[model samples]
Target: MFRFTDYGEEDAIRLCKELVRIESTDPGSYEGRISEYIYETLRQELGADGVRLCRSEVLTGRRNLLAELPGSSAPAGSGKEEPALVLICHMDTVVAGEGWSEETGGPFSAAERDGRIYGRGSCDMKSGLACALTAFCREAGERRLRQGEKAPEKYRTLRFIASVDEEDFMRGAERVIRDGWVSASDWVMDLEPTDGRIQNCHKGRVWFEAEAEGVTAHASMPEQGTDAILALSYFICALREEVAKLPEDERMGRTTITFGQITGGYRPYVVPDHAKVWIDLRTVPPTDSRMLRELLGRAERAATEKVPGSKFRILLTGDRQSIPPCPKSRLLQSLRQAVREATGEEAVVSLFPGYTDTAVIAGTLGNENCLSYGPGKLRLAHKPNEYVDISDIRRVMRVLRCLLREPLR
Candidate 1:
């Protein structure tokens, strides 16, 4: 019957494996290859004019792939036009760190075992991307069918955006918003792995560098130079104390600080004149970059004051704005209904503990009609032997199928 539901488990598994086989890691890496593959796939389905590869001028070789499919016209006498729906996915995965070896298979091998696909990006997001892409294509084909066989009116337009640089700065998502690729009426679904649940709220992230400056001197004359390392140590301690006082949220969790990296001193013989520590802060609502910066300023003032003749500078590295939990919206209601219809179970509504590109899509972009719902376990992301269950992939596809059919309903 040429039904959209024909896009099944095997298809999703195959597509996910193919995507995982390509190593699209972040930090000095680009999403050109993966974005091109997606563009070609959509072009083959909807012709060249329907798909486009948008490269960012700021990030060379990093690309954002976009595909659009127009929906059916409004029914006669109804005079109601459907709102557009945007399917969003990131094209980058965290760096595949050490621990991947031949014994466990390569990170990009995409090996199948125990009904799961083993690879670097499998659990983090590639499976979710595959499901979204396949569902979009399936619905596009249905819209192109003969007149008598067409379905009822759904969205005004279906737009799929595979954005780059999500694992790092989220500049790809910012570009999409700056370019005005979406509007207030468009509902955005960031297909990040949520294990099988639907996520309406998530924590935000702010990264900064704390630099401690001191005088340089020979190691033998330790008292002659203000030790930058010791000054930074004092700063770290003060930062710990400041973060401890922040309030906690039951769902979104508490604001926490992580000292990711530290660098100082040239050699053992010389007291370093400069030292810097990278701090990553995970903040809940009411705790944004500005508030966090103020806390850091306090820490810096306390530390530098304690260690006389030492100066500290707080530089913001990156920020993902925070938003409170959204009220009951049409998009969330439709997604919950889709999950219920597809899995025969009420969707589990919860908050995403970690950061996601949804922060940019919903918070920075000012598009409140956004949520994260997809396949794979959130715990498995950025870990060794990351994998996504094939059954989960199929379930996500089924939910998306229902979403495409009756988005507004």
Candidate 2:
């Protein structure tokens, strides 16, 4: 067992500041430097064989770093191995837009004041990354040393995955699966910004684009040609009405729909012949991928019925599965215990409204033993002047220390 004080507050805050300084924003930004930093740190702590980089397929030289802490030793003569525990942290941050210079210094300033670290990725993720990395180091340090060291004790193997592209297509998560870093029996924890709550479940999403086709004509005579934009509007209305009727989930609340983007018409003078609407459908349990696709088909059919001669096609973008709430599990119990030990109160469990890479890893790795728990408020992520409470970061470290106290069996 390890002490909760093994990793201190000062070191955690310092590392978090260092991570926020690295501009790993998405869309053309590369996670190479941050991944390298994590890899180098883990390699130094766990040795060369214990850490490796899982390169991304879409991004050149981009990689997801994985580190393993095999503990001090293995269970004696059991022949059966302990279930592995995996910790996941995303390395990318959203694009830091304007209006951040004077208000919060800058997106990458890593400025500290009044017990908060202000920066672009500070709250959204860097804080979580720091927690995961620090926890990994502490666990690895538990192994028996060679020089003047006592006999090693057995503990479950621990793994860390610093993934990339979480702000976009999630290719980094796919890379981990391709590299075979995850296993079925492994328990996974995604260190997302949760404001000290334990998120055992989250709503999923089905993203797709629907294109409406129509006949074009001069703007002077609107009746002479079919307006694709008008047809798309009809479809959107019908979709909203249909989604409003879907049964609400007790935990996830409701199946929400968002028209993220719409594009049509080259100029005002001509009636556009084609229009496309990007739809984001938040899903819950009993509403699997196939059901969502069918619902889209029905919505399209309803739109065609409302506006004759308007043909449409739904192009699939993504379908992330909704994670079921793990209300009763040893890991969940352990997490609650950790929270109480750290803060003298039980963890507030809640449903995550946004999609996370946990779904992708769980689906691909064939393990539902995954959840999210960490520091920072969920609302502050991706906003201007983003920041995470330094106290919350320290509290998270204490909880992690408690959770990592003993090896999983």
> Which runs of model 1 end up more than 4 angstroms from their true locations?
1-6, 48-58, 73-80, 101-103, 149-155, 407-409
Q: Write one digit per residue (lDDT tens) for candidate 2, span 1-409.
A: 1123445667778888888888898964668777777777665566654444334444786778777766434562465776677898999999988777575789999999888999988987989889988887776665534324564456677888888899888888887777877776677888898887888787877898999998888999978888889889988888788778777888888888999899998789998889999998888867766876777788888877876788998888888888778777556787888899888998888887887777687666657677888789989999988999998898998888888875444
Backbone clashes counted, model 1: 0
Best lDDT goes to which candidate? Answer: 1
What local lDDT score does residue 177 receive in model 2, on the 0 to 100 scale?
77
- Residue 316 of model 1: what lDDT? 93
Put down candidate 1 lDDT per residue, 188-295, tens digits, no spaces: 888888978888887788899989999999999978998899899999999999998998887788998999899999999998888999999988867888888889
Cα TM-score per model: 0.92, 0.91
Identify the leading candidate in terms of TM-score.
Answer: 1
Each candidate's lDDT (Cα)?
Answer: 0.81, 0.80
* Pairs clashing within candidate 2: none
